[model samples]
Target: MGCAISGLAAKAEFGERNTGDDAAAPAAAAYLREDQIQMIKESWKVIRDDIAKVGIIMFVRLFETHPECKDVFFLFRDVEDLERLRSSRELRAHGLRVMSFIEKSVARLDQLERLDALALELGKSHYHYNAPPKYYSVRT
Candidate 1:
């Protein structure tokens, strides 16, 4: 299944067209499809928005449920950085960045590459807090 999806994605032409005004247009035409691309574009937009909403809700709920974790985030915060992240625009941009990564992961659900990377990052971050993996089981 994984191979099949990868193969399909590789072959799928996301029809984007060029008006031939630029010299680089020919190179850009290779991966750009104009017609069937709408499905992918719309699907990603929906998934990204949904993930952003869910991520915000979960972040709030998580902070509420485990107030202790707030200290972890605060540890990395400078006054300016904290204030920047607290702004609505900055927060939304951060959310969208995270959501885009998540949307790509979901789109490649047949592969474990993103999942492994996510786990590795989490493990590394956990080490910084001196958190044992067993703490997750305890929380659950």
Candidate 2:
């Protein structure tokens, strides 16, 4: 499948990790350039308040694009009408929770070590929920 989103993670070789090659990896310190960080910060300021809406849109797109992903979300698995989900209270609540995490991630960007730990914990949480990284990524 063609890439749809820049910078967002994508499954590598059908979700199977490729062998690590240090030469292909960017230096950790240069991962996010100062100008990139500034751009992200400025963009965050514009949408921070609308994160709930953004979250809802994000998940809605996820479900629509990859119907199989619904199996990972018990509450949404049986949902038949994607349009109706737009007004679902449960969905709104979940959206808030997801967006809140994004907010925290943005806030901790400068603290890479802390952010890394936070991400590790999040992956563990996903493991407990039986949601694999493949389900979190977009596919076509």
Candidate 3:
């Protein structure tokens, strides 16, 4: 199944960030709101040990909800089954790494440069994958 959401609908709901370009996320310093910080810390505290699973679930749900996203991954192109997909080494490794980065993002929320550097690094990686931010539309 492809994404159930239309472009218009996604934009309406996730309009906080603009992903159409290579530029940094607007207001990067103040990106995480007070409430969001509390929520992130609270949630991460609970799921910290299972971040790998979080990553796996995130990608699995992404592909399940927007099947076309699978096309972005050469390794995952032929796989549609979530269980098998989660079991793939590449999926597991990448998922864990991403979740680790997310953990850092949350941990260094007060230190903008650390998060900025990470974003730049991730942007370079994403460019290599041919996945601009618009493709994700900020699922977080």
Candidate 4:
């Protein structure tokens, strides 16, 4: 996926710094209280089952709002039809990968250092794929 965890970067330690427009998430998540964390974990339970579907929908919406973002994914760069991507095996696979990262990220929330490190690695990997943090957060 683009930048693994959009707002999880440790300052500018991640590959790219998000622009003002890209600063969608608050860093406050890093300071979430135990009760808040528990609430998030509980909320996630309902969404965990449809992780793949959520992943697909998230990307579809991303591409819809930011078509240029497709250039970051070789498989989608030349495709002119957006609807067809819905059933694309490649898209589905990538979606699953993205969702899997989110699942793991959520699982590690209680372990902030581990979660930050995970996001750090993924953010660093984005440079290799030319995926910028800009595409990580899109307006819906």
Candidate 2 lDDT tens digits, 1-140: 11232122322312323335533432132255566657777888887878888888988998999889778888888998998888888888998898888778777767777766776687788778877666454223
Residue 8 lDDT (model 4):
40
Which 10 consecutive positions of candidate 2 have the poorest summed lDDT? 1-10
TM of each candidate vs. truth: 0.39, 0.73, 0.69, 0.72
lDDT of 1 at 49: 53
| Reference-based lDDT, each prediction | 0.47, 0.67, 0.70, 0.71
Candidate 2, RMSD to the unseen true structure? 6.9
Highest-scoring model, lDDT: 4
Q: Could you tell me how far off, in angstroms, the CA of residue 110 lies in candidate 3 after the best superposition?
A: 0.9
Kindly indicate the candidate among 1 and 2 with the higher lDDT: 2
**Local accuracy of candidate 4 as per-residue lDDT tens digits, 3-117:** 3334445334434444554444433335455676788888888888898888888888889998988888999988878788887888988999988887887787788778767
61 Cα displacement, candidate 3 (Å): 0.7
- Of candidate 3, the 10-residue stretch with the lowest lDDT total is 1-10
2 or 4: which has the higher TM-score?
A: 2
Q: Give the clashing residue pairs of candidate 4, or none.
A: none
Regions of model 4 farther than 4 Å from truth: 1-28, 133-140
Error of 2 at 5 (Å): 11
Residue 20 in model 3: shift from native, Å? 22
